[model samples]
Target: MTEGMGDKTEGAERILCDEGLRVAVGGLGDRVVVDVRDGTANRFWTDTSNLEKALHGEAVRIDAHGGYCVIEVREGTGRLDLVMEGVEHKHCDFSTGDLADAIAMVREQSDPEGSLVERA
Candidate 1:
C-alpha cells in the first residue's frame, strides 16, 4: 500500500496520525503480516489472520480505554473485530492503536513463551 508495495500487500494501510507511528496490514505468500512502526522508526511485524475474521464496517470494542474502532480490509470489503485486553470493546474506524494492538496480539499468539523472537 505504500508507494511501491503494490497489490502483493493487500489490506496493508497506514494508521495512527502520529509521525513514525504506523502499521501495514498485508500478506507475504500465504501469511498475513502486520508491520508496526514505532516512534523510533523501529519496525515490528505480526500476522493477524484471526483478527481479520471479525468482519468490517461494524463496531468493534477494543480493550484499551474501551475505545470504539472499525476493521476494514485494504482494497476489499471484509471487516474485522477488535476484542481487546480485559474483554473491553470498541467500534469505529480503523486506527493506529487498534492495528498496533492487533499486531501485538498476533505476535503473542505466534510466539508464545518468546521462542520465535529468540529464534529470530
Candidate 2:
C-alpha cells in the first residue's frame, strides 16, 4: 500500500514509487483525476466519469496495449487499483490524494486542448 506524502499542488498530494512511477490525485470538475505516470508517459486507465464510478465502488475496464486494464477505487477510501493484463500482468496501487497535482503540471506543460483529449 502507498502512503500519502507531502502536498504537490494546491489541492493534490503526490506519491513517488521506487520503480519510477508517480501518482497524483485531485478534483477535476465533479470527478477526481487519478493521474499515473511512468517516466514522462501518463498511464492513466480511466476517464473522469469512469473514475467517478470507480470511486463509487464500480469496476471499470479499458482496452490497453492489446489487452485490458481493470481500474477500481476502493470503497470509502478513494484508493486506486490498476491491474494490467497483457503479455505480462502488472498491478499498481495509488493511495488517496496521490493522483492530482500531475494534472496541473501536465496541463501547464502540454497543450491544454490536447491534454483534455489525452485525459479523456
Candidate 3:
C-alpha cells in the first residue's frame, strides 16, 4: 500500500503486487477488488518492473471489461522497487506539481456530459 494510506476512511491504498505490477487499491472485499477504474474483473500479475517506476501524474492502462481506462498515478511510495501501475506513455519526470495538476485535468475531462456528442 502507499504511504499514509491507512489513515483515511473509505480511501484508496497504493498496492504493489508480488509480481511487480502497481495498482491503486480503491477498496478491498471478498471477491470484490475496487481500483481506480470502476468494476474490474480481469486481473493479471506480471514480473515486469516497468510499471514499478511509474510515479504520480504518470498515466497507466487500467484493464477492465471490454476496454481499458487510461489513468494517472496520483500518489505512490517513492521507492526504487515499488510496483506501480503500467501505462503507455510517460513524459513528466515524476514531479509533484506536474502530477497534481495533470490529475486534476484528467478528472475534469472524465466527467460525463449526458448524451451530448462532440463533433470533430
Structural similarity to truth (TM-score) of each candidate:
0.29, 0.44, 0.23
For model 2, how does the per-residue alpha-carbon lDDT over 29-109 read when each residue is reduced to its tens digit?
332334455443334434445654554577766543434445565743444334444223445665433333333432334
lDDT of 3 by residue, 1-120 (tens): 111112121323344231233334322221112133222222322111213223433444433333333334555432222222453322222334433332333233321423222111
Model 1 misplaced stretches (Cα beyond 4 Å): 1-20, 41-48, 56-119
Q: Tens-digit lDDT track for model 1 on 1-120?
A: 111112223333434333333444544322343333333222223224434443343333222222222345454333333333454443233453555554544434433333323011
Residue pairs in steric clash, candidate 3? Answer: 22-84
Most accurate candidate by TM-score: 2
Q: Give the distance in Å from residue 75's predicted Cα in candidate 2 to where it truly belongs.
A: 4.7
lDDT of each: 0.36, 0.42, 0.29
Clashes of 1: 17
Q: How accurate is candidate 3 locally (lDDT)?
A: 0.29
Better structure of 1 and 3 per lDDT? 1
Task: State residue 44's C-alpha deviation in candidate 1, in Å.
Answer: 5.5
Best candidate (score: lDDT): 2
Sort by lDDT, best first.
Answer: 2, 1, 3
